[model samples]
Target: MDGFYAAYLTGRAGSGLLLFAIRGPTFIGVDGGGVKYDGQIEVVDVGLKCTIVYMIPAGTPNLITGASPPATDQRIPLEFILPKDFWNGQVVGITTPLGPVNARFQKLRDW
Candidate 1:
């Protein structure tokens, strides 16, 4: 599939979110289970007052659905973090295949 997707982030630490855009082809499991996606996504972080591309490696599992992949892009809130530290900002961008998408972060309130 070729299109645009909006990705974002929320929470922090073990509760962090990795709202990704599912891309590529979809297929059923050998056991005729839920669908699965065979594509990758570009995880962009806007929590550092800047845009950073977080590499999800090449063969990261459980990126799609728990059992079957959705027909369209799904916003999955997975546990995400920046190394040993936590995400200090909000906002995230999601683009698949290729990107240079526009994204921004703003301070809502002081914590």
Candidate 2:
């Protein structure tokens, strides 16, 4: 199986919405593997409360489920601060080699 996973943090800082996300490729290795190059946030639409990320290929064409080799040792990190009013229900969409995966923001607590 080939996919991706993400870890994110979201919060309200005054009138702004703070967001930080880290994403990477995932796979179940057997006799083959996958490679992920570098990834970047392609778009952030506050109006739609959605973000899109794209992961570039490292030319390896194989999936890596364990220790990443030097060529595929890359991860995607995104940070943003937007209007709080537009981020009530934000979703992050990531495009990987296999396909697309989504992560939703949930309020953890209030400060």
Candidate 3:
């Protein structure tokens, strides 16, 4: 499973939250469910108002060629999982560096 990430800053820049559009495997539990991705995280765009200079778990590189700073196809190794329990208001999904703590909602994909 794989997806692209976009870093979103609230009012300013530098640091903020991450918006991910992932198409991967889903995890279902008695408590709730989520989407689990394996291997690595790919960077598509930093966002319209932001820019991701670099990421983690190098060696591989970004598939997008001819980037301005030359984006790598590398993958950032982390415990990334998007929980399906948004109403509960629990700190779930995308834990590593930091979870999407400010995620207002999650839109599931057909994957």
lDDT of 1 by residue, 11-97 (tens): 211112222232232211111122122323333463212123333333433432222323454433222222211222433443433
C-alpha lDDT of candidate 1 relative to the true structure: 0.27
lDDT of 2 by residue, 1-111 (tens): 112322342222111122333233211111112322233332345522223332424553323222233354344433333333323456655443333434354443432
lDDT of 3: 0.31
Better candidate by TM-score, 2 or 3: 3
Clashing pairs in 2: 33-62, 33-63, 34-62, 34-63, 34-64, 35-62
- In what order do the candidates fall by TM-score, top score first? 3, 2, 1
Better of 1 and 2 by lDDT: 2
Residue pairs of candidate 3 with colliding backbone atoms: 60-74, 61-72, 61-73, 61-74, 62-72, 62-73
In candidate 3, what are the lDDT values of residues 1-111, reduced to their tens digit?
Answer: 333344322221123334454444322211011122233233334311112222423232221221222234433344433333332334433323322333333333333
Q: Which stretches of candidate 1 lie over 4 Å from their true place?
A: 1-16, 19-50, 65-93, 98-111
Of the pair 2 and 3, which is ahead by lDDT? Answer: 2
TM-score of each: 0.20, 0.25, 0.26
Least accurate 10 contiguous residues by lDDT in model 1: 26-35
